[model samples]
Target: MITKPQFKSNDYKNGLYLVATPIGNLKDISFRSLEVLAKSDYILCEDTRVSKNLLEKYQIKSKLISNHKFNEKKNTLQIIEYLKSGKLISLISDAGTPSISDPGLVLVNECIRNNLNIFSIPGPSAVTTAVAASGFSDKFLFYGFLPEKKNQIEDEIKKLSNFNHCLVFFSSSKKLNKLIPAFKKFFTGRKIVFCRELSKLYEEYIRKNIDELELFNNELKGELTIVISEKKEEKASQKLSESDINLIKRMINKLTTKEITDLICTNKNIPKKVVYNFCLKLKNEI
Candidate 1:
């Protein structure tokens, strides 16, 4: 039997409301989010111009205040003052939930410092949206955006490669294309999903094995939410044989640890860590 939800009247409170807006399609907004925005004394927007389109669509007339990354800290005092004065101010990003790779944290922290009331009016989120559609393990980690520097990005990806659960990331099309090589190198054997223009008319989900992924010849438009599938289980590598230990004992005095590791791992299915640790155990025994 299907049961309908019993809707209740919202008792709008006076405080800062961290509202989640639609990631793409403006129609994806919730009734509760709309009601809160409609009754808000003011709306704090990451970009008033971008937010205006959504607000106007729903006929919400609340005064808009610019509250992006550059000006959030400066606007903190005044916003806190408004909250203290019992004003119902709502903070929203241009899209998605505020503070999820978006502005709103500064003002939220200010509200907390002043012991002011704060509420979250949840709605659309690109992270969960992409992960849910990925068909990967539900256990996941959301790494908001990758770093810009090549070395930093490489280091980050290398570290993230160790996790066994699904991983999500946000990136512009250009950045994502540039990252294809790095993704291929570190995330080998994993499945990947590229979610572009989510919920919009041109929405797309490009799924591929990491090894099979290739850079697009033509540039793709809009932001991308990427989901990498969880690591696949592999058969445990066999323990070193008596001959293997004797071979390492012979080379232990002649080759460096790294050289030994590289040489031994060249043809073996064993992990470098296992070989490296074994090499170290032989060294310490000397």
Candidate 2:
């Protein structure tokens, strides 16, 4: 059966509304998101200057409140009071969904503590956009931004390397260039995609193997969404046979343990660790 979708006017409730704005293109916003913003008594945003462009484009006249990381905590109490007063308030980031690597969580939590109503106006997301286009595994982990310190960044990458699912990260071009070395060192044998200026006119997707990635000589502008493909699973090691054991026993005394392990692994499709362990066991028994 064929059916036509019907549009209905929005009847907003007085509470906090987490609205999602376009990441790049102004027209990428949903109609429902606009309706919610239009009906909102006040819109809390990370940056009023950035949100202004979007509002002005849609001819939306909703008042905006500046709420960023620095001031979000201080603004939470006042905002909660507004929600308690039965005022319809909306929260939006400079781009993408609110509270996603942006301001809005503190206010949302305050609203929850106050038992206030909250609504979600989902729309665009750089994470999903990059992952979808990267041709990587859909299962992903979005680590918003890498730490500033080099050691912290390495530690973070080391932890993330243990996961088998695709990994997504947000970084500026300069920072991304600095991160390429770390990515190559930790994420070897994996594929990577760099999504630049996503959804914008100069949008670009650079795909490369981790080993082939090199630093950009020219400084690229705008934020980058990096998606690394899942770790490649290793082939199972074959069990050592009686003939293989005898060969290792014969070579254990004549050749060094490392040489024997290397020779056995190179001759057969076996894991180096497995061969190394057997050689170490025989040497220990001697």
Clashes per model (N, Cα, C within 3 A): 0, 0
For each candidate, the alpha-carbon lDDT, in order, equals 0.89, 0.88
The number of the candidate with the highest TM-score is 2
TM-score of 2: 0.83
Query: What TM-score, computed on C-alpha atoms, does each candidate reach?
Result: 0.81, 0.83
- Name the lDDT of candidate 2: 0.88
lDDT of 1 by residue, 1-286 (tens): 3222233446787888999999999879988898888888999998889999998887788999998889888999888888888899999998899988999877777778889999999999999999889999999999989999888999999999999999999999888877888999999999999999999998899999999999989888878999999999786586876777788989999999999889887877778888789999999999
Clashing pairs in 2: none
Report residue 221 deviation for candidate 1 (angstroms). Answer: 0.4
For model 2, how does the per-residue alpha-carbon lDDT over 77-154 read when each residue is reduced to its tens digit? 888888888899999998898898888888888888889999998899999999999998989999999998888888
RMSD of 1: 6.6
